[model samples]
Target chain A: MSDVTALHPGDTGLSVATGRTEALTGIAAGLAWLLAAVAAAAFDDLGDWLETQNYAIGVGVFGLSFIVLGLTGRWFPRGAAWVTRAGPWLIALGLVLTLWQLAAAKLGWLPQPFFPPPQGILEVYTFEYEELASHFLASFRLLAVGFVIGTIAGFLVGVSIGWSHKAGYWVHPVLRFIGPLPATSLLPIVFFAFPSSWSASIFLIALAAGFPVAVLTWSGVANVNTAYYDVARTLGVKPLGLIFKVAIPAALPNVFIGLFMALGAAFSALMVAELVGVKAGIGFYIQWSQGWASYANVYAALILLALLCSGSITLLFRIRDRLLSWQKGLVKW
Target chain B: MVAVELRPEQPAASAGASLDIENVSHAFDLDGSVLRVLDSVSLNVEPGEFVALLGPSGCGKSTLLRLIAGLEPPRAGQLRENGQPITGPHPSRVVVFQDPTLFPWRTVWNNVALGPEAQGSLKQQRERVDATIDLVGLSQFAKAYPHQLSGGMAQRVALARALVNDPEILILDEPLGKLDSLTRLTMQSEIVSLWRSKGFTSILVTHDVEEALFLATRVVIFSERPARIKADFRVDLPYPRHRGDPRLAELRRESLALLGLAASW
Candidate 1:
């Protein structure tokens, strides 16, 4: 890690010569964004469409910032290098947006209602942001609560089943039976059984997250090197110490894998639970927007959901890397 | 000023404890059938004695070490340490297995501190742990993780880990079996010096006849499966015994002959 950080600029992918090319790409990305802005503003709608809410201006500013970054890259070398790495993708996004403007709102090649232009999507974020933000918050809250409860419960269940033969005999069969079934399949029963849709949604998310965690935790505990237990025992470690210190630490790598799986499962469960009955969440928002034929709002909510999930997974990976830094060449991230 | 101390004063060797293994027979349930591993194996080790058990690959030497360490109860007989029956694992009786088995997640210092940490005496034994690390010549690598250390260094850390407990009886199950020849020779001497300084009752299981002859004051040879002691002889040598000693060479040949590997060599 230190070696990479200490590398000279000449040895890096973004050498002085490449740095110049990166600046040019940044400028090119900015120009493409400017073109997208012009395309959105210059063209007249084929039919009556909702107000774009100064979406063109927003696009213009985004383009301007890119142009500025490209021009002033030398002042912030590191930040500019990062921007340079992302330059091609930025240009591609601009080209895609410009094409969307031509196809949907301007030329009517694609129906306006079903396939709203990038500006239309931007308008949802700009104008109906309050509603979207509220739904996002609601979704975030539900997912957070459900995932936390599920992970904690799963960890306990897994540890218990792993450590004791009696617990394993009882819970292992139940887990094997239920663990494979998708939490979404249990929606009808869960909704019927729980008092409120909110509680039901939480339960569903928890169920989705919990199963993987439980199974993986159990695997980790059960598969711990018997030598570790022997060492601890000879050292006068009590039963509880054996579980917490020896078993748990050794099982952490496996536990992280389970946590990652649980995160994915929780995301799936959260969406299904929200889509089925939750009044205010991104999933419900998407459903409601689809009902109103507001595809732009749907697209915006989907983007937010993708960001939330990916960001969460990234955060989990970061935590795992830090915790398991001691591990070498055994498992790759 | 009055000061209260919670535990007994730390002893270097903790006054080596005598071990008495009396007609101990052990077996394993292999798919519902009892596969006997030991047959009434009886041996008495005096305090501070370095006794090496030499045998073939599957001669149950390790199983006997485990029995002595109280990792498992023998099927038929009792093993006593300092006149007390070893029902289960105790800090005073520790085994260093063939594998270093240091926790990958822990630094060398933390690994060495495991005994005290497990016994809930880490706060008091911290200095002893450091001293043991230094004793094994690993003071510089105390903060290094197990994965970073070479095989020999890892074994040294394992030694420090067991020694930090101030164990009276140190059981070694082919502890140096996996090391390279050069490192193995260095470690053999280190073990001898440590045994001398600590005065712990050491029982080592080794496959190498020369190793047994060099390090142990007494070498006990065992027969094949369900191991029974075939021969026991004393190596009457002083500290820092030379590898080229004619007496050691004579004993190695005898040990090899007993294990039925003499004809090949």
Candidate 2:
């Protein structure tokens, strides 16, 4: 077994192969820079381009970083380990970017406005960071509030429906009928029912998040091994105690499954909800930029949305790791 | 090593409870058809007696153990402990099933601590949890999750969980059935010693006649499904009985014959 300290790259032993990989990564990065420099110097017909000079500076910085790394990387084993791990991916990314630049800016094979240069996307971050940040924060707030409320409500309803026969008899049919329906299909009703667009959007997001959590939680609670209840009962655990202590803990892996499903649904709902008259958020920004025919801004917003959704999911996974550590090897993720 | 005594602080009078099963009959509904498992079975287990229910596979020995544990009310008869009728499961009667069934989410310590926690006595009986874990020789693994432990180790944790309750009647439903032969032998002695020290009324159900003869004061053999007692043999051996004892060997042969395995033996 590896020692706990091996979690730190500095504490890990390095091989000659790893050092060689790092050197190769540096060479690939340098080659990418050379290609980008030649393309920029040679081509001048890439008209009305935004942040055209910034690409050269970006390539130059990348090349210098790799060259320095190749020379001094062996001295810093931790940094060298990171370089080795990312080496192949870095090489692929460099090659892809070189090809992309050659096709778009140099050859002009792709149509204008449809396929913006990579620098056009980067320029959005530099020029419109404040607007993007505000939209991001707005979207984040709606997601957090909707997710928290939805999950709490789903969990309680699920436990109730699962644990009590009467509750299941009444609630199960209702859930079955409503849970499968798309939350977006109710957008017209949601808009009219709520006092403001924000509340309507929040409602849509909540509805989207709630169904998966409720369904999965219900299944989880229902399918727990009866032996656990038998054990708890023999130990003199009462109904509430049995549910909280035995059933909930046993159902955690399934609950996490529900949470992941909820996240996907919530992200979808947030985008759709924002497009329906919400002035702030990534979804609104996408629609707003598309109206002005700024496809570059649309692409930029899309990239931000991708990062945001993935980041939230990753955060949820980290929480699951902390809470359900006992299920570590049992689950592949 | 001396058998680790359990609940030494509790009064001896409240330690073991006598079990009386009167004309018990049990059946399950299989696709709307009645499948009788145990029929007209009656037995009286004395307080602190170590009794083994020896039967063939599918003979409902485990069903009987579960009845005694009060997991279910018998279909026809009354099961009583210390003159009180058994209506439902209680902490006083605990069963160790063939599968350890330790909550996979809980660590060894939390699993052992469950009884006290359930009974609302965890604050006062906290040390009993630690002591039981130590007695089971799993002190070092108290914080280890159930998945981290081997089959034998998980079974040991299950035993400790029952022992922590200091149950008056400890029901064993082929608790060591899944273990390897070597671990099975070791657990047999461990169980015997625990029973001797704790003085709980132990009802161990096993198909192994030798195992029954080794640890039990009396071996009750059951016939095929719709099970009824075929024979009850009193083992008059002393504590710390050896597997190689000639008397045990003799009784083993007799018990095997009673179990309808004479031709095979």
Candidate 3:
């Protein structure tokens, strides 16, 4: 801890003090695990209690981890940073899980079939991993296809409408009328229009994703600074060159805004589409599990959905960062 | 130091085209009202000569440059390039706007390469593109994007972009207007050096009287509102004229008085 404190100047005492606090937090986390283990072993459960082996293993592993991290964290700066940052959150998570186990499983404060112990949800992952993986893959495939088609079609049409006066005149009013109609609200019509449930789902997702791209692309193209066009024109850029070179590049920041909106809308549409008629996806898994009162499976599937949505959004943001790096400080992330 | 060399073999004789603006007038339709910007503006810029149009703000000096660039058709009369009537924007004439107007998406090299690229001569003139960028002292920043540049650096890229085309006429619409005082002064000399080297017929529109007298071989002043060529003065000083030259000081005073400002110099 003293060596770590020497790494940064002007704050030696404060740094040493913070390092001590970090070690203390780690010990507290270990203690919380011990307390949970004691409760699990001694307390009488209001409901039928399963064997406490899983809880015992978890407590032991966590307790060992905290003890190791506390003693040796300052030796490695990278490890120290992680421990300092995540130590409190880990402690809070452990406390929350312990309390949940006591209330939901031991005391039966929350009714069964609706609320399950944390171990029960973990058990679903352990037992039904294959089925969950398949469902996730299916949903991912549908999202990829629909998202690609929608974004491409939307971009082309938006660029056309924005670039050409004739196209704008013909399409702008029609877009204005239909673009505002929510894609989910069109489900009844979509069902009648499409022959298969899969096609209907894809269509719904595509429509959901396309509107924002089109509208934002239109506005982006329309609002490009006239000075850019003037400069390009004097440089001998033809009409096609003007559209492709000046208008498109200038409008890219707004196009990314459209893509972000499309991602959100696509996710919402994906979930709803899967719930309505899709045979196998995470959303369908949730609905099917809910019908049989398998709350553990439902919670497990919900967790997977959360991870998948956030993971995909993160991927999109990474791509945006790479392409639009010039706009770094101008936009507030 | 790698000596920056512009392509000397690129037909220097036809590189500068004499501009003849004969009784030209232009107006803009501002919300169903005709705002007369230029009224019978007539001037001649000889090939390889540096001419400056000096005027007050909103006096349509820039509008006249745009006309010469063929960006807009005059409301009346004709603008000619080497005896040919100007009908539309051509590759032989390029305008550098006050805003730099560097496409934010492109790097310094790509922005400067846009002119040759548009002309479909990028394949043949690739070396010229590299040379022009080097000439502007931005070879190190070839791959740097426009947003990464300072105001002065971006404007240098803009100038490089115009020069790469090897335009017969280079029209500058107060291209250094947005720079800080120090950057502006530096750029003023850079522009003069570039003009001296290239020897393209140049027309600069500026509100700064000192800038006009410093850069232009001939200075034409415009009146407010319906801008007409009020007066034209020839600067016969030798190349590399001193800033504190008594002749320049005399002309600055007279030009300021003509523009309805008391000379502070």
Candidate 4:
């Protein structure tokens, strides 16, 4: 038993003694951030910029918090464990921030307008937050509507094809022909055909998300265990029961896979649609900023989009984990 | 007032239903070629009889059970249950297959509750499901998932799932085929007791000779693919028969000989 525990560290509550290195990393990260703040305060920017006081204060506060966390690790063991896990990432981020500040802001080595200092991006957020937020909300509304409709329609289509030979025969050929075409390629035609740009964007997003969902859900339903159907059949279950009770539940793991793919594709389609078809979104904000040649706004909007993508995907996985808890460890994310 | 007529009680009909498999021949089309499995097999089982069909692996015994369960119709034959032509799957004819085949998503209670739920009778028969789960000695595990179960435990849950329906004809397709030896021994006795108590007509297909001798009232042996009936005989032993009984040993030896493994015995 001891040998087994030795082989699998942390299995028997014998987690490796850690946090010392993490504390060291935390202190180093704090020093790096403080140095970056000093550079921001001490140097003059090569590009047109706002006063560096707020940015320097923000960096200094972040540095102080890290230093406190590093010094007071004994009080919160859980927090310490988290810090231990994130030590390398924290260190890397701090060093990168310091280097970026020195390279772009202090020294005039990098090109102006293209590679603005960290403060330039931060200033965009500080001043133009309201506009960015409105754009985010618009994107959110469009994405939510399109994604829900696409998921439902795709799931229904998949089920119909998977469960019925007639449906499969009729729809499978069409799906094969059109499913692989990127929704963005039809942008000009779609925008011209629809009554409104918003509707066209919605349609494009749905098209992008729906194809993978339908194909994957079809395969999921088609590949159910025959024994499950037999069991249900012997229990006097009807055809509908076989599809809903037996097939759907059995195919859920695969359905989740389809949903993940759909979400990723939906995001791509959303950005493209917003870029060309729609007037207001994060993608639109980036395009608008690019037109004005304000690289700082573009950078800010891109970071926001990144955060949104990460957050939405994380939420999707959480829901999947809860619903398919029985299938934990069976399929890797 | 309308006149109401009363009929006399017929206990036999309620106890178990008789099964008749007449001239059953089955084949599967594999790559445009017909692979014949069962050839002109006929067997009539009396109500409440425990009949065991023993044959070589892949000799179409399971296919025969499937036909009896009305999962699939025989290529050329008629199956009648209680003198009515079998059409399709019915709740009264439940099967405990070799693998547990329990839905991983459902708990033990829900898995056993499948029959009543599918039949749209779960609301009233909820207690019956619990009682059935308790019968299989898994009351504590009623809420446990299939993946959480050991092989024997999962098999017991499968048995409970079949029993919860109160099937008149319990078709067991090698139900105990995959259990460990010790669990298999325990389950063999459990099956016998359940049959005696419930008085359900049982048709078990297994490869174990000793298991057949121990649990079944009559043992039917069949030949290889395109299977033909080799022998049919009654065990004639009373319930709770000893494993070391001289008569059982004699019967086992005879059964092995019929299967053409006499030299080993």
Candidate 5:
């Protein structure tokens, strides 16, 4: 982001190391997965140990996960690239726990009231990956649809209100009253408002996400310079060309600020939608794992969601940089 | 096609009829009281002549320039060019304010281009911008932003923007007053050279008698507030007058003495 970043050397060595570590971690994960498959298949004894869930064994496995994570953390790349750096910690912890369960089960760390170690959670996550994907698809589809519609509507509404004094006066008061009234609070009312099963989820998600987009767009439009208007008038750039060429470009930087806020709002609304009861998605997977006491599966689901959110935001920032190149060194995304 | 330097012109006789300002007066009513600023001021600037209105602070000298520029209509005077009445700002007449009021966002080149472009999107106007940039000797600073430029450069950009349209008459209201002494001196020489070189009809407003005496064909001195033309002195100094010349200094003392600054000459 040339406009946003002072961009001091940006550490070429760090970037190189980050790339190298990511490749190493990807290879490591691949080897770990192969080892898991072969180790799980070669010994029926280890498989039985995994299926047993003694509380002491579970705690031992969970504790081992953290120790392995704390130790191998810096071996990964980017220092804070989260994607490359976080994966190894997650994989190592998951690995050590897999080993920890088998080791603990054989050592008689469990007595009663609890099943054996990591076998059950692994069985659910590994064997049920297909089942989880289907559920994730349902929530993700609705989130995509809602986010798209909300963003577009918000941009149009915001620009209109910001550009027109009459629109600002007439529309802003009503939106201010409504937008702040938690979108989730309207879920119960929306459940029966539309015909679809996830209508409430879709409506709430769109409402929550669209408000920030509109607010950002309107403020951007409102703040465009009077000098541009005067210049445009003298140049004979009447009505149509004036708004597109002058007003829109001037306001783009502001609109990006709103969209950045809306990204997180969209994700949170998706979470709320899932919590309110959707058949599939990362949220539903989380809820399902909680219900059945599958905590390892829960951790895996949370990691995947974090990865997607981080990736989406990084991508959005890149797009913003490309679009507003004229405004370099103004904002750092 | 590539215009980079102003083409020097031989001094030609002035092109338009002289301006006639008869019985001009101005007043500002502040709160309840009426403050008379200029009273029965009258003067004429002959065609192609360089006239400098010189006076002390609060003598309403700049206000008179603004009135001539048609930025403000005079209360009691009939201001006319060639014999016709003056009205609103026309492309034929331009004013350069003391502060260089060029738009900051645009580059020096675009700022210069604005005058001609504002007229129309005609292809030939591009030629005018190039020619004016050359005229102001700012050919190299065309792409520079105002924030990147020094005060003198910014003022040159402002002048280039004004001159690009090749206005028939220029009313400069203390255009070099904001500059430091060194830059002010440099600007004065540049203004004098450009005026003589282009042979354009010009009216300069200033409080500096030396600047007035050095630059104008006719120096119109004004009395302090409730201002009137106290004296109209013609300076016979040729183009490129020698600085600090005894004769020029004597004229300076004469103009200042009329303003009651120094002992009467």
Candidate 6:
């Protein structure tokens, strides 16, 4: 990394290509004009029908977005103005849509759901904060317990099978028969067999996520240079020392990648598991809210889940980076 | 850093070991047929002696060095280090691989310090690491990794790492064979200077006849495969002799001819 410090940014492979920037700008300007024309023409008579048509509304917004993109692409593709202009552009568009929703609903404008209005969603977030937080906590707790157990167990099993042929030989026969079977499908069986509690949720998460970590970890350990083994042998390192010092450090970079994959799978599994014979968690809240016809709250839960999933992944990435800072920029994803 | 400069070398008296090879033979299975790599090859090195084994590729020069270093056991014969059969790799015998083979994960100091910390007293080992770092002229690059060093620099670090242990015999597996010609000459000179200063028994396995003649007191030439000692020629030339120097060239021709590489000269 220190060796790379002297190379200039423009010369780097990282910098974006100039041609791509030029093309995008040209497209954005053309789009903005087309959108402006559609709105201008539709404003006269077919405005009500145009808003009522989801397809038309989608196309109009898309065309207008391209216009903005074209302007930026031509003059300010990735500059501060491009990002700064986006907020005002979106607010203005939202204001127009809201005004249209009020007028168009009377005139039978865009489909009923399309204009649920920002105020309704905001009411769900601010007024129902306490209710959403508990659901958030429930899902997070299940994920925390399950992901941690699954990741650690997977890493250990992976290292064991990867480091020794004996471990691989003895465990591989059973692994072949069992590992390929989907762990998620067994959640129903587990739900029926075990009491409906956090234990079952944790178990479900662990089962679903464990396999990838083990397999990826095994590959990482097995693929290191054989000369590393020879060097360790010459140095008279004992078996345990070799595994700990040589194999683990060499395999960790790969193992972290495996963990990242396993994490996403774990969260997905947790969501499905939370819905089974459960009355808590974000998934449960979405179902409960839909039953009550609180569509705004249901959408809010879905958004919250998306935000949580994104946050957990980002958090795990930070932890992985910290653990393996020796391998800087190693976690490219 | 303390730099203790030696007055001069008494090449025989201080060169590290007296190794006894008694009828060592090694064979491998090639397509269900047994192929011999070394055939009853035997040599002896007195303390502080420099021996260069010269041969072409597929020759058992490296195989013989590994045998002496206890990298692999001989099938037929015994290798005696101080009147005992050589077993597995020992700290007393360190190998400098052609690629340097320094551990990339460790800094220059830690890599060299590995052997001493493995076998010697802790306080003594740490001091030895610093001394060897200075000896190899890598004191400034102590914090650097092997990948950060050039080919010549890495090989020097390998040499320093092997030397840090204060090994009895230094076995070089063509350690400088990959360097450019100018660097090779400079390295060869540096190696000789180090050997003279440290007084370690050094065995260099190389195909270069001129290098063998310039560096070794006794140059042992080997056959192509099933390599056995074809001839052992003593240079009788003084230290730091150039390849073009008449006396060294005369010996180089003799060693080359011994291996059937040169026409009548």
* Top TM-score prediction, candidate number: 4
Model 1, docking class: high
Clash count, candidate 3: 0
Model 3, runs deviating above 4 Å:
A1-9, A14-22, A30-52, A55-59, A330-333, B1-14, B123-127, B262-265
Separate DockQ for every predicted complex: 0.81, 0.73, 0.76, 0.74, 0.12, 0.28
RMSD in order of candidates:
4.3, 4.4, 3.6, 4.5, 9.3, 7.7
Off by over 4 Å in 5: A1-329, B1-47, B53-90, B95-105, B171-174, B205-208, B220-233, B258-260, B263-265
- TM-score-wise, the better of 3 and 5 is 3
The digit string of per-residue lDDT tens for model 2 on A298-330 reads: 999999999999999989989999999888664
True lDDT of residue B57, candidate 6: 91
Question: Distance from true position, residue B121, model 3, in Å?
Answer: 3.9
lDDT of 1 by residue, B23-117 (tens): 99999999999888899888988888889998889889899988888888899989999999989999999899899999999999999988888
**Per-residue lDDT value at A333 in model 6:** 51
Candidate 5: Cα lDDT at B36: 85
Model 1, stretches more than 4 Å misplaced? A1-16, A47-53, A329-333, B1-14
Listed for each candidate, the true contacts retained, as a fraction, are 0.91, 0.83, 0.81, 0.81, 0.04, 0.11
Best by lDDT: 4
Between candidates 1 and 4, the one scoring higher on DockQ is 1
The Cα RMSD in angstroms, rounded to one decimal, for candidate 5 relative to the true structure is 9.3
Report the C-alpha displacement of residue A22, candidate 2, in angstroms: 1.9
Residue A103 error, candidate 5, Å:
14
Residue pairs that clash (backbone atoms under 3 angstroms), model 1:
none
Indicate the residue-level lDDT of A38 in model 1: 90
For model 3, residues B1-265, the per-residue Cα lDDT tens digits are 2233444433244458899999988999999999999898888888988999988899898888888888889999999999999999997899999999898888899999898899898888888889899888999999998888999999999999998887889999999899899999888888887777777889999878888888889999999979998999899997676889999998999999898887454
The numbered model that scores best in DockQ is: 1
Q: Score chain B of candidate 1 by TM-score.
A: 0.93
Candidate 6: which stretches are off by over 4 Å?
A1-116, A192-197, A277-279, A315-331, B1-15, B30-32, B117-124, B263-265
TM-score of each: 0.92, 0.92, 0.91, 0.93, 0.61, 0.77
